[model samples]
Target: MVEHGKGHPDRLAQGEQAITEVAADRLDEDGRHEGRLVLTPDRIYFLDNEHSSGGHDDVIDHTRFQGAEVTGDDTVGTLALNWSDQGKVYEGNTLELRTFKDAIDDQLNP
Candidate 1:
């Protein structure tokens, strides 16, 4: 996972660039799979892998996440980032404090 100070510029660029082999995976219960894609001023992270884990792996590679459409709630903020290639959608929630802990676990075992 990629961690940076709040409002890091690299994190912001991730939302705008075309990243390849961006780590993608799915949770057991259809929840989101959150992790970092790259480390730098511009990083791209993903929250959910529901679609990619299914039969859309190639679709995700073809599409590039450009921006997010946010839907906020009390506990979390959901985002649907638009992809450039296959019109695929990358769905995820805004990063939270606990997210870092989960990412650490994955790194140790992954």
Candidate 2:
């Protein structure tokens, strides 16, 4: 069964492999949330520390992933994920953002 409320690695579904995970701040209209941005083969999960009490704050399936854009200075960057009708942004270390971009790009292409 697919786990919907937990944020830890143990919450991942069986046979689902994590491609990348990083400590980042998820940005939304309301505010920023500290969370782990986890990219798995089937979904992109924003596991927020504060908002994950009952349901997922954000979970984008691979088929819904449209594109990603990264922008920032030398030390930090923001990764913006674009999907069908919505988007999500995460701010974190520059290198980590690049890693996320690459992984997402690979998924989109392959």
Candidate 3:
């Protein structure tokens, strides 16, 4: 079987297991932007769809993560993630908040 999405999961980690993938977003100075969220056993990847004019990728280590949660209703909400890097706290999330949280929780617990 073949999988399809905005980005390629294979580009993440070679020979590593992929837990899940979803269309998501990341927090930036401008605002929330569309991105491809890929989950592995030990890391979370938020990569921008290269086809887009301005796209980038964020590789977050689970150990550096401080916390994560979903807020607001399905109508209008945000997926929030907190992490510490270089002594600074960083935030990352997607507009599909609930869906993002569920995927992360399932992988964390399963």
Candidate 4:
């Protein structure tokens, strides 16, 4: 796929700009490789660096984003970000998840 900053070239819309992106550990599956989560002004993007089924990048538009919540703590283990989109749920971990999610949430919910 063509590259567009931190996301795929085919994933963006006109005038869409990436606000922030971070490397996240995919905790929803076993032996999963780390992925990238990109936040644009109007969407949340999950880019798979390497995935078992050969790969797929997920985009959750602001209207489809439900919420992102911390499901664990650094003290106990890696912090996990739990989020839902259009009735599907996803989980990933990143030291930056909370911060990134908070910022994205503001833009999505405001």
Give the Å error, residue 27, model 1. 8.0
TM-score of 2: 0.82
Any runs in candidate 3 off by more than 4 Å, and if so which? 1-7, 51-55, 85-96
Tens-digit per-residue lDDT, 51-98, candidate 4: 524246666777656666555556222433334523323344434566
- In model 2, the Cα lDDT at residue 84 comes to 87
Predicted candidate 3 versus true structure: per-residue lDDT over 1-110, tens digit per residue: 01223257556767556566666655567566666666677877776764443236676677776666666553555556666732211233334455556767776677
Give all TM-scores, in the order shown: 0.32, 0.82, 0.66, 0.64
Question: Backbone clash tally for model 4?
Answer: 0
Question: Rank by TM-score, descending?
Answer: 2, 3, 4, 1
| lDDT (CA) per prediction | 0.35, 0.77, 0.58, 0.58
Candidate number achieving the greatest TM-score relative to the actual structure: 2
lDDT of 2 by residue, 21-109 (tens): 77789888878888887778798878877864626557788888888889999888999998887998889997878877887788767
The residue pairs found clashing in candidate 4 are none
Cα deviation in Å at residue 103, candidate 2? 1.1
Model 3 residue 32 distance off true place after TM-score fit, in angstroms: 4.0
- Which is the leading candidate under lDDT? 2
Q: What's the lDDT for residue 82 in model 3? A: 66
Q: For candidate 1, list the clashing residue pairs, or say none.
A: 10-41, 10-42, 10-43
Writing each residue's lDDT as its tens digit, candidate 1 over 1-110 gives 23443322332333543222233232334454543232222333442334333232222221243443445455444434345632223323435323432443343335
TM-score: the better of candidates 1 and 2: 2
Report the Cα RMSD per candidate: 11.8, 4.9, 5.0, 5.2
